[model samples]
Target: MNNKKIMIYGAYGYTGELIAREAVARGLRPILAGRNSKKLQPLAEELGLPAMAVELGASETLERTLRDMDVVIHCAGPFSTTAEPMMRACIEAGTHYQDITGEMEVYRSAHAMHKEARDAGVVLCPGTGFDVIPTDCLAAALHKAIPTATHLTLGFDSDSGLSPGTAKTSIESLGVGGAIRRQGKIEIVGHGELTRTIDFGRGDKFAVAIPWGDVATAYYSTEIPNIEVYIPMSPRRAKKMQRMNRFRWLLGKPWVQNWLKGKVDQKVRGPSEEKRSEQKTWVWGEIRNDRRGERRIGRVVTANGYDVTVHGSLAVAEFLLDYGGDGGYFTPSKLCGYELVEKLPGSGSIKVGID
Candidate 1:
């Protein structure tokens, strides 16, 4: 029992439930946890695991529940709000912590906790999700393939849809515009500031600069001087979307956000069981070493984005179980080396294309 104990915070949410399901199937007993007991109880029973109620805002209550746990998989959404408090509780209780957070600001905050975690001898890993894991790991792999690489550009085309929580958070970030790293400094750019079209087999798809967590991860992972991450949007439509986002500042009112959320929730039907079963994501990355007069490009395709995220969360859990006690807050790239990248699940559901 002691060896099987793992807590799945936010277990009732879309991604959290998936993680709980995956954990149970792997013979790990997950302690289903979240703010609402009534919501988590049935899930725990359905999965045949114990359930505990936890609220991030209530630090004392959170700490008490986290005690004696071998590890915790935080699947809460919009991590900007939930990660910090939960991390504090984990450090206080000496429990190893991992989260699927992709928010750059949230990652910075978690990274700041490294010293405290190290002193306490507890592991803290953030961005163990689709947001940065595959990208970060793949970036590391590319850097190794071309040792002199100095810049990287990553893009992807995902047939999978976004979950409600993910959509909500994305809409919130719309007004903030996209961010990129140029010459080793973080730069914020307005929507459509930089646009290009890249062929992804299906056709030439348009992409725009987006404030993805990769900007933060890639800098720490590889010695690339410039890094930019983009998400595909149809060229014609991309322009329209940019226009809308540029004016998002006017809609900053809470009521406008609520309205947008409702509209988005209705339009973005998260990947259905059928969709998840069929959806795939293809990612491309290019590393250029101008000094060496060489460039290496790599590509990877995987099952549904959410599933990849679950896999990453599990990877973190496994890492923690094996070697996390040394402590310190760390990103995936910082914790594991090239070998870790190679060991990740890369079966038929995931394929890597490199050149």
Candidate 2:
């Protein structure tokens, strides 16, 4: 009975289910929504929350649903495909759109709608989860520390694995190589083309550049002309990732994607409660302007990605409700402020220092 008409689309997925349970714990009754009622209704019934089932392919159904929602915490993915329609529907209905997407493509595309969202008086923000929240905030904090920063590098290593939806996104992108921002433009490069030693506040780890969402969001948050983000990968895995470039065509096919999805569905159920409690997620970022001879560094530690997603998603929804801001396209840092990462329920600590 929170009286906030928030809807959790894809609420039956792994992270979505977690968000729904935690939303109830926090006294917000979110509608359990997704593409299937057979799956959604049970969880909705168990949680005593209302439920809705609608296909994104059905424009009328999607539009009708959007008209009823005040805000949507879109848990569906790979959002690269689902987002455009949903975003348009939300804008048309004047409903705030928030999603847990970390896809660099999604962020770039969403950023293009700043004016429309502002005109519609609705907030359109994605990367509400670990995908870029910690790193994006770190980038913003470092930017605030050194406004002249011309280059930014962000990285993270988490003691956890992907959920099914996350794994599917990863599989889809396996053929897409990697990307980095250079002079404010996104540049695509070979997979594992860039590797560096990063100190994620814990210790040194070999991290390789991947198409993380921060590559897009950090640029907007900091106005930095160059940005790259990484995650720890062992030598063998790095080599395997590089090898994937030669087979991009095969890996990107729909049937092959489905086959890999089958593998992921079999193996990835995400971490359990005990594992989530035991895990630690770390993010590191550096801001530098060689011409100005300045350097700033920031690091953060947080809970498992999924846990942070649960808390971060709801936290954002709460912010839109309480902060009462004019709507526009926003990065996590822009919408919630740089302290959002540190203020998040499960995010551990943040440290910024001059280097």
**Number of clashing pairs per prediction, in order:** 0, 0
Q: Which segments of model 2 are wrong by more than 4 Å?
A: none
lDDT string for model 1 (1-355, tens) is 4474578899998889988998878778878889899999999899899998867998988888888687899987668778888899999998888888778887778778889999989888888877777778778878887777778888778887777777777777777777888898888787767777765435677788778888887887786879998778867766876787657777667788789889975776656667687877777788888887788777666666787778778877877777734798677867875344345454132233443
Worst 10 residues of 1 by lDDT: 346-355
Ten residues in a row with the worst lDDT in model 2? 346-355
Error of 1 at 349 (Å): 11
Q: Which stretches of candidate 1 lie over 4 Å from their true place?
A: 1-4, 200-204, 262-269, 338-355
Alpha carbon lDDT at 332, candidate 1: 83
lDDT of 2 by residue, 105-208 (tens): 88878889989999889999998998778888889989988899889999888889887878887887777778899998999888988999988877888889
Which of the numbered candidates is closest to the native, going by highest lDDT?
2
Point to the candidate with the largest TM-score.
2
